[model samples]
Target: MFNLSYTKSFMIKQKFTIEVKIIFLILTTVTVVISLLILFFTTKEKELLITLGISPKEIELFINRVSQELILFLGITILVLLIILSILVKKILSPIFKLSLATRTVASGNLDYPIELKTQDEIGEIAKDFTVIERSLKATIRDLRERNKEIELLSKITTKMTTRLNSQEIIGLIIEDLTTELGYDYILVSKLSEDGEYSQDHIFSGDTQMKQAIEDILEEKIENIKAPVSKLPFLPDVSSGKIVIKERLADFIGEVIGESQSDAIQLMLGAKNFVDVPLHIKEKPTYLLLIATSKETITKHDKDILHTFMRAASIGLENALLYEEKTRWADELEKKVEERTKELEEMTAKIAHQEKMVALGTMASRMSHELKNPLAIIRSNVYFLKKKVPMELMKYLDMIGRAEERSNIVVEETMGFVKGVSLKKELANINDCIEEALRSLSHELKKVEVEKEFSEDIPSVLIDVHWIHNLFTNIFINAVQAMEEEGVFHPEGELIGKITIKSCVVNSNIEVSISDTGKGVPQDIKDRIFDPFFGTKIRGTGLGLSISREIIEKHKGSINVFNNESGGATFTVVIPIPE
Candidate 1:
């Protein structure tokens, strides 16, 4: 059958001529019609001439005249028919030719051009079909481009995760990326206990209203759990693999732990409309990735990709946990060994020295306060003297100014060691503090092209305004210094420097994060950033962050540092919302 098919195709290619066949058909029909007309005319003429008894010469002349006229008429009619046929063929084939060219263009991966032929014919129908094909092709290309972008972003995130080696940061990146790219309103990451209890560790990209709602649910559950047996009997068990009522859980876990249930329910509700994947470690449930979206349904392909990511993330998480645990154990063992050695070598001397140091610290605190007022007065006097001093005396005034500033810094550092000293706290807008700090450094910020993204609805917190200002100023100064050291400052070109101030509520506390686009602190030095006298600068007075930490702590707050994923450092401060 195959050989016959091949032979038939070969024969047709060699023997067939479509043009010849069409020409032959036209010629044959024309010849037949002409012959019939000639016969009919001849018969009619013979009958008429015979009836009239016409002479032979006259008949011959009439026949000759009629033959010439018939030849002329046939030639004119054939020429007109051929012209009409040529026009008809051109009209019929023009659209098809355009469509063929369009198809070839599309095949070469150009969908920008469409077949633009409008006719009320079969060709018009083909054009419509081509439009549909073109739309579909464009959509496919767009989807591919979007997917490629997502993959590239994910790759960068993964690389950052590996280098940072911080689990919290990794989860943060995941939540942020998922919410931004996937259009999710809320993302919750939870870990399940061996007995089925769920502990949600992170919630990202949720509005304040949603955060409050989730918090209320958790609080109600927690309060119920804390009630006496007479009020509530059983604790809500989320880990039981069954959805339990939030109110019921209040009975099991104390209000503190029960309130966590509301967060779980919020997650469950989101999971129902979105995607939920369990992160597992060694066949045990370790974490859950909950994505809540406004979308009606998740496509199967999206689910497949999410599931694959979940699997990979689960492995990565388990490995990270193991590494962390091992490191923790090693650290504890080393600490114990150090403690034992210290105790054996200088137990008596250490105790005596500690007591002396405490006494000295107490005296230093008193002396610092006493010296601060005097230093301030001298600093003010030096400023006044700078305006009145002669050119020769100007250098002396500058020296005095430096000495005064140095003394004030020393006093502040001494005061940092003094505990339980509280500043006068007032309700303050965090944005005000941020702006004031930036204003003080406006010249530097303008040079760097500062980018501000402050949350408008951040609630006010009771804080020492001066302390907050100082804290922000110190961080800003450090960032500027880091950028200068790294040569990241671009004057004529686009500025490489960027400072971001963002505030949000986390766990009922106001959290402020200040990020700078500068070379970050090295890992070895990061943890010591808040320690006194840990400066990396040439001037080397590392008391700025130490004093900042002290001020924040005095207001019952906490501050920590982390490297931003995009080549920078971020300092995060969390303080309670004043009652």
Candidate 2:
């Protein structure tokens, strides 16, 4: 393969040689023929003059003149021939000069340089060869440029796609590069379903109006378009790691979408050629990238570029999928750790609660046994003295008896709280229970006014009467004590205290409300009021409300305390009615 410069140089050298040869041959032949003609004409004239009896001096003069004129004519004729040969040489070499110029222009990277030479000679043949070489060089240059462009696009795709670890985002970037950088008319990415039985359209990037038109014709959103792999017969070929290119795309699209809609969609999109390339993950095809254009043809080099792009994209997709999986696993592991930590915390708390209850039970056990004996002896002595004492001392004895009984009740409450209470459920009236509680606190209720609003239609509740009585007793005692404390603090003569108790059937349950005109529970500690050993009182076991809550919960009921509208606090208890 001779380079253009070498070929041009050689052809120019050949042109020079051909022109020299023709000039030499023509000039030498002309010289020879002219010399012979002069000799012959001189000889014939000499003989004729001699035969006519001419003088030697006259003959010599004639011959001399004739020779001079002939020599001059031959000189003029040779000069003319030389002039014509120069012109002919220039004309013969004209096409070669043009071809040389054309070659130089092309060598300077101007493929568009015009080559116009027509002849019926070797020069013409050489010109034709030059034209062919020019075209071949043009195509080669164009191909090299195209390959460079493809390399550049691939470089961009690799840079952009590798940085993205999100599958959808990588897919989007692929579409953008294909359409915007690669100059494809449209790009669509369809992902294979997990079952490997369906390929669903995940992205479509193209003209907005064209996309809308396709969507409308299919009567489905672009993303929602899907087809079984079996229906699209070309997909298997794609899945098997082969690039599938289809012309007359309507028939192929008709297989997936419908025959009728395909024609309309093809028209709207103006897509004549379509190429589908497989996108692989873990060495298996998991997606298809479809590129379409309205152009009548796609070059083999273009398809090769598409294949290279798809390969890079497949690697990107695999990386993204792996990243997502890793993230999901990380999240799941974090959640599991959190759940296990919560369980351990709950178990630790439960064990601590059990230890605390054990300690409480031990204290209550010793206190109950120690206090009960002393209380029994004091009450017996008080009874014995009541009979022996005079009327004045009888009051003293009664006070002693009351003090001993209060001590006994305290011991019983402590014991009951430590050793959880057992219920003996029976059908009984809640009103009757309330009246009994108030009666038990009669000796202490003299300073406070008590009002009762009992409903006659109250249903009989199945409850442990003893526990219910104890629950009410604890609430009443707290209320009276709160009021007594309030009176002590009052700047006025004394705080006017009132305790109102109401019972009614509400929401298929026995709702009892006990309202007192005493200090209300503080807002900050409202939620914690039911907790064990929590209270506002300076001197108390703090088990009253806690025990009450436990008993009510045992009965499958609820008890809540809130500030009343009038003043002080209202403790509301609701016990569900038996069906």
Candidate 3:
């Protein structure tokens, strides 16, 4: 019940295992044979001398001479045997030693070095096998590297395609990316004709010579392209809408051209390995992507990458087309709305509603086209500046970025909604914007006693300047008309009517109260004041208060009305001041 140890024991498995035993056995056998020969001759000396028919005195001399020659001959024979055995051992195992060294060299990443051993035995066969393995390993590593390069190129193309939405721009980018990745000697993109032939509208990019050669090839086969590939030198990719690659394109083209019109194609394209991928947009095959390279065989994985890139370009082009269509619709609608505006009295209220939509669309498209570029620049610059400024200044940069984002949202809303009004928001002192609004209606409000109780210490709030100006003007106009009709304003320019506007910060919000000394909002329709098309005036559009409420809510603010205890109605507006 013990764990077995791999350590060698002294008797069972000695250090001198087989090699020492072979040397020991050889020496022992040689020594014992020499000893027996000397002992047998020396012991039979008397018998051998008498048989030789010589005197006993001469017999001693003969025996001594014979023993001396025997020992010398044995010495020379043993030396020769040792030399032969040394050479034989080295010859027998030399391929094995060389094979081991070559394996180590290959393992160390020296794949360019070759394994060479010449013999006619099992060892030679083993060396040949090692040579095959070396070749296979190098091919596998090369293939893996090529696959990784293709994947990286595909990722870069994806990044570039996602940032662009225009069709031609996307196609141009695809041509550039694919040409760079595939290292094509010739790249040609041609639109297909109504008869399914290759059209002349081809986009080609690559070497000048290769492009010319490809152009010649196309010209020669111009009248024969009845199908993607019908007796064509290069097979077309009609089956899958992808590329058809031919590794032996040079030979095929040479055969087609009758070995007359040939130049560097056979040499440059290295057997004319090429691909032809069809660029399909909205499921209609329109353009063909042709590429021919000198080196690097185009595999199926590479084709897959190219196909995916082409697919993205097609989608981007479709989106661009749809946007163009939407733009056209918006323009036509605006023109119709403009014609309707001139005849507002004759047209129904439904026409007026259409005017609102037209206004929104025209403003949105114009503003989006104008502000998108600058706003993007502002946001990016602010972000860059935020990184370099001190911690204290970061808050201001962040605020500026937020303001840009809000402006972009307004642009998006205009384009996204037909009846919605988009507002460009910024931090403004409500008192100043309100003053500007009242000034916009100065001639009408001249006779009214407009009192302002503005708080100078109030924090700045984010509100749309133009929209807030309109909101204040609408209220002032309503108040002025009411007072003028009620005889609250005297004819001698004496201001008898009063309009009070006050603003102050209240618990993280800026509140503005505009109160008028006139008839209050009717009790029955007080809740419907902000409702669209609910005005009681004969010519009022009824959209003023409704739009004002929408602009307030978009800024994350609120507005409501209350009956004054003294004599009029008060309109209260609350806007948050971001901390």
Candidate 4:
């Protein structure tokens, strides 16, 4: 049975070249038959001529001549047929030769070169298939390279996350990796509260324009409210507040939870695309991982990778939060355990500082609420004057209106800090906010050449309006102060001082960055600049950044101060928006 099977296999293998063998056999048979026919006809014709009355010698000559003619004709025909067959064979085999060479090249690991075949036959189709194979191989190589890069980046992020003990530092590292390494436009990592609400916790990559815009909007909304001084919007109400889901809620939940829940919230929030995964601890959903891209669809691979990242992030974040909570508990326990003299003094000082802050926050909130109505009135009157008054005075009127708007923002931010009020979350245009903030500071920004780069396609965000406005004003004022200190106000100078404000939506948050070409923040005070009541200038309140932080924290946002590599101080604020 094995012998028979082997024989059948051999026959099947031999069956492939049957057509070539048949053609060769047919050509050989035709050549043999033609040769015989030529010889017989020539001999018969010569004899017939001799029998028909030609002389024997003449017949012999005729026979020889006919034989020679027959031989020459047959030789020429054979040569012509052989030449034609050779040309045909070469034409048929050229593509096969090229394909063989290309295959050899591919086997040697050179995938860039493509084989070119012009024939419209089966060989050409085979060449086409080879080309496709080559392309696929190249594509696969490219994909592998990208994957390697991603893995390298993941490794780096892992190292950084493990080494950095500070939560803010870790978040910054993540954002930096996503922005610089992954080339993400924005990155927002939010902590999901137990109530299924997102708190704006960490933002890494963002531009100045977006941040300024957010700040401006937040300031304006708070200023616009007609509220009593005692009932100011402030911090306790704002911090850890729930982000309202308006549009794209289902998509967000699907991304953070699972696709199985997409239908449940479709009626509440219309969504086209989103990705969400759960961050679990002990099989319980401790956090929800959400990501939103400008892309209309999320690929399965992307979802898988993002899920992996979220798992890693959840572990890190959970560890940090737990550590913080434990530290707090430990400190409390120490206070109770050690009622010694030194401990009492330290506790007294800490209590005094806390009390002072509370009192200050309350007083500032009251003053802010009181100032808002007057600022609004001034703004209204300025607008009225601008419309009713002549164009010559319109510029002046607009400036007055802007100044009033700025004052209103400052006031609202103060009230927000005092009252602990959360911003009324809404979809806000980042570009519009930046434009308005710049416009409000036109008089001041115009003194120093202002440069702006605003991305046209930034997505709107859901955030508190008052806090963002405060954030922008603080940064803008700092820029103005830096320029003033550097004496860049001279009308004639070789070096023109400039400030650049840029905004963009990256990852899932809005970013605003402000950079100035002035004497940078001094290194000695750079670390303490954001602390309350820490100011380098004698006339300055030192509370600008401190208040800014308060407001930002209230909105679950962040503000960072850094010296630009080129020159000057750069302030960047990132705000997370609800999907």
Candidate 5:
């Protein structure tokens, strides 16, 4: 549109030009008519003026002056018209040039160029249309820039997700991008339990004070907040891969936790709107991405961007879960392989031990047969010499008898240990066997006190009475010897060592515990104490505990030793009770 003053001025200038032309035409016409009339009357008027005593020079002067005045008036009018026309043209051309310059400025990509047109003419109309085009171009460019930004953000997020395999790390990256890149006020990623019965916050970002306030209301840290799915009534639908948008932040929070806390949280967080997007892998939603913002409106473009982002996230999260599962399986398989290899090694060692023991057993049997007659003959002669020898020589004969006795005992124990004992099972009371063994070692126990606690409920068990008696005898002998070696007797020659034996029923087994007041077994060699040929004593056959273990095993029982709190060791033997 053109300006009013300029339109009026243009009209006035055109009217003035037309009037000037008209006036000039009328004057020229009038002059032509007068000349014709004067020509017609000039001859008669001139003669009349001459007859009336007028001169020829005066008449000529009058005509010439009248013609000059008319020509001068016409010249002044034409000059005035030319001046008005020039002003109108200048006014019209100035705006046209300005509009042209504006068009060029806009074409050069400067949409902010000012366009002002004062004329109400065709040029002004063109300027109006040009202003509209400039505004439209500015808006289109602005939209394009925003779209490019969203594309760049998606590209960066995709790159980051590719490098991260852990679900938590991927989640952290996503949250980081939303807050830092997209300028979100708060983000909460809640993971739904596999059973779909609970929703727990896995990661959170933004508004520390708001987070603290919500944490206080929930009585948990924001990240550790776990609430039942029933509390979040919309979770079932969300877990079904639905995206929920809530315009009222308070209502959203209320639905998530409770209405009592929603108002307070919304006030603290300055939240205006939020969106719940289900994060899925393999078509199953496992997480809910809650995005809250302070902006008054969340446009469709924002939702579209978020939707595209989550689709990529699902792929990343699925790969991450697979990687985690693969790692766990690899570790478990490695552990199983190691365990199987160790079991194989143990079996190989056990087989080698059995083979060596069989060879030793054969050699022991042969040696025992060869030495039996010599030992018998030596013992018989020693007994004969001890009686016939003089009083002074009786001590020497006694020493010989003791040496032969020790040699016979060594050969018997070696044979017993190498060749495993065969059980002659008989239903008998275990306390009776203990009593018999104690009776046989009475002479050695002269410096040791023996206490017994035999349970009244001890039942008859199917056991080899001979071997059971021998087992206790070996144990009692060892206890007695341990005390003797440590000089456990009192200075007055009184017995100080004590052996306490007890029997009880435990579970389906009979347990016998024998504790001594002597020095306990050394911890360093405790495990090897039951190994054949391993001993601490100077003259021990080293087969006592080993043979005892074999006898227990033959009876389908177990034997173990531990130090008593009192001072010495206690050997406990457990024999299963027959049903």
Candidate 6:
């Protein structure tokens, strides 16, 4: 069969034309040698046959035999050549094929993929060079990835630092970033005292006692060093407190810190390398950016990032200090303004009170003259009615007399509020005064329930008995008026009101508070309740409470009014006890 299958497989796989070229070369050389030998031997044999007088038929027959023999030998040679070429091509391409597969794998990012080509040829040399390049590229990629992570972390940090203005927050964020993102074991953000000493403000890691020992050591050590003031040509290197990173800290633990404390830190956190980047704040030279790592030594890139953070931190610190100062200033200004406001209010109140008293005095003095004439006419008419009227009409005369008398009393009290009235002083029982007021208003209190919470231990108040009587009467009358009425009958009637009178000796005063449960004092009218002639009642002049207040004030006492929680108004009168 005329077939060549193995060679076809090699062409599809390796793509090398070496086997085809070699086979072609072998076939061309064999054809050339055979043609040359046939030319020489056949020419000589033909000449010898002609010289031997051979027959034309025998020569033709001899040429045909040689042709058949040549065809058979060429066919055998071509078959042998194809077999040899297939074996050689397979042998050579095995290593090259493996290298090709490995190259594809390497291109796909499998750097550790082995190039198992053992051939010592040009192909092997190319594979060896490719392996070297892969190793170098792998290392480069790892470094790039590490750098990218740090840069991304830095980007986050930059965003954070520029965002908030709080110094403590920035410091805390910096410490957190260092520990969590950058892998630090210990960090401290300390402020230096005015006298050039370090104070540990925030400690991030390690055992408490050991860290404290280190802090104390740092403080003592910092105290001895020249403070890093800008006055110097170069800012002296301090620990994380200043720009100086002393060499001794890197070599061994406590030469710069303290032997025992360094040992403690080394044992506590596997911290070896340390970094001190100083932040210059406007307030003082006591600022520091102290950081340390446990596993790897702090790298140059880390230091660069730390330096940038320190600069931002310095700005943040100054801003916070300024903000604090501004806050203090604002607070002081507010306090002064409040005090001044209170003073102005008091002055305004005093002026208003004096003006009201003056106005009341003026009006009373004027009204007295005008009212006396009418009063005298009233008195004369009543006297005449009593004489002329029959006995049956005498009751009407008595009512007229009582009305005229009440009018006179109201006028007198209204005038008395401003012009000091002569007081009839007596050792009067306060409870008796309250009882009298209740008794006077008993007709109104018939529907209202009265409750008393009097303190038996209360000291007697120093007051004019007549004035105290008026005061209690005014309070009780107001209470009875404020009580809400429901109905006229018994069971269905819920007394729409209640009055609670409580008395107690508070400090140096006898305090009485009268609270009523009724529709609460209208918020709008509460301030005007004590104003003369400001009456809610459809009755005579509204002078009762004004006169009551004046009388209490005359006794060196004060009266306050407010809404009761349950409902209605509570009038509290505070009267000082008799010396």
Cα displacement (angstroms), candidate 1, residue 490, comes to: 72
What's the lDDT for candidate 4? 0.64
Residue by residue across 1-579, what tens digits does model 2's lDDT show? Answer: 237677667766876786677878997899899989898989999999999999999999999999999999989998998899779877876777787778767776788887888887888888888888888888888888877877887988887888799988888888888888888887656666765433445545555555555445344533334574345443324545667877756456655554434434655446777777778788777776667777788878778888888888888888899999999999999999999999999999879977997898798889898999989999999888888889998878877887886677678678878887788999999899999988877877867789999999898888989889989988998998888776643365655688999999988889999999887887899998887767788888788888899899999999999997766899999999978
Global Cα lDDT for candidate 2: 0.79
Question: For model 5, what is the C-alpha lDDT against the true structure?
Answer: 0.76
**TM-scores for candidates 1 onward, in order:** 0.37, 0.69, 0.35, 0.37, 0.59, 0.62
lDDT of 1 by residue, 1-579 (tens): 025445545444533354345567777888898898889887888779878999978888898898789889888878886787668657865686677667656665678887889998899998999989888978988888888876775566556545545566666766775677556666566657665455544444334444454445554533444444334323223343322223223223334344445554444344334445566667676666545555655676667556555555555666677778889999999999999988877888667756865886778778887898888889889888888879999988877776775466557656755653468888898889889988866755665757677777778878788778878878887888787777853566645787788888777788888888788989999887886657888874577898888888987899999888888899998888765
Ranked by lDDT from best down, the candidates are: 2, 5, 3, 6, 1, 4
Off by over 4 Å in 5: 1-114, 120-126, 152-164, 168-307, 383-409, 426-432, 442-447, 452-462, 484-496, 503-510, 522-528, 531-541, 576-579
lDDT of every predicted structure (CA atoms):
0.68, 0.79, 0.71, 0.64, 0.76, 0.69
Q: How big is the RMSD of model 1?
A: 28.1
Scored by lDDT, model 1 comes in at 0.68
- Measured by lDDT, the strongest candidate is 2
Q: Tell me, what's the RMSD of every candidate? A: 28.1, 9.1, 25.0, 33.0, 13.3, 9.0
Clashing pairs in 5: 2-119, 2-120, 3-120
Q: Give the per-residue lDDT of model 6 (tens digit) for 1-579.
A: 112354445434554565456667877887897788678767877888788899978977887787688768867876787688678767776666676667656665677997766678888888888788889878988888887887787777777776776767777777777777667666655556566554456454434544654554445543332333233212224533444443334334333333444455454334555566556766456565555555555556767767666666666667776787888899999999999999999999879978886887788878876887898799899998899999999988877776775567666776676566667777766777888777766766778788999889875554577678778877776776666422224476656567899988889788899998766678898888787767777875688887888888878889989987766889999888876
Candidate 2 residue-wise lDDT at 220: 52
Give lDDT tens digits, candidate 5, residues 144-243. 8888888888988887786678988888877887788877777777777786533545545455655555455445333333465346433324644767
Q: What TM-score number comes out for model 2?
A: 0.69
Q: Which ten contiguous residues of candidate 5 have the minimum total lDDT?
A: 220-229
Residue pairs of candidate 6 with colliding backbone atoms? 237-244
Q: What lDDT tens digits, residue by residue, belong to model 3 across residues 182-221? A: 5555666777765456665665555566666666555554
Model 4 residue 261 CA deviation in Å:
74
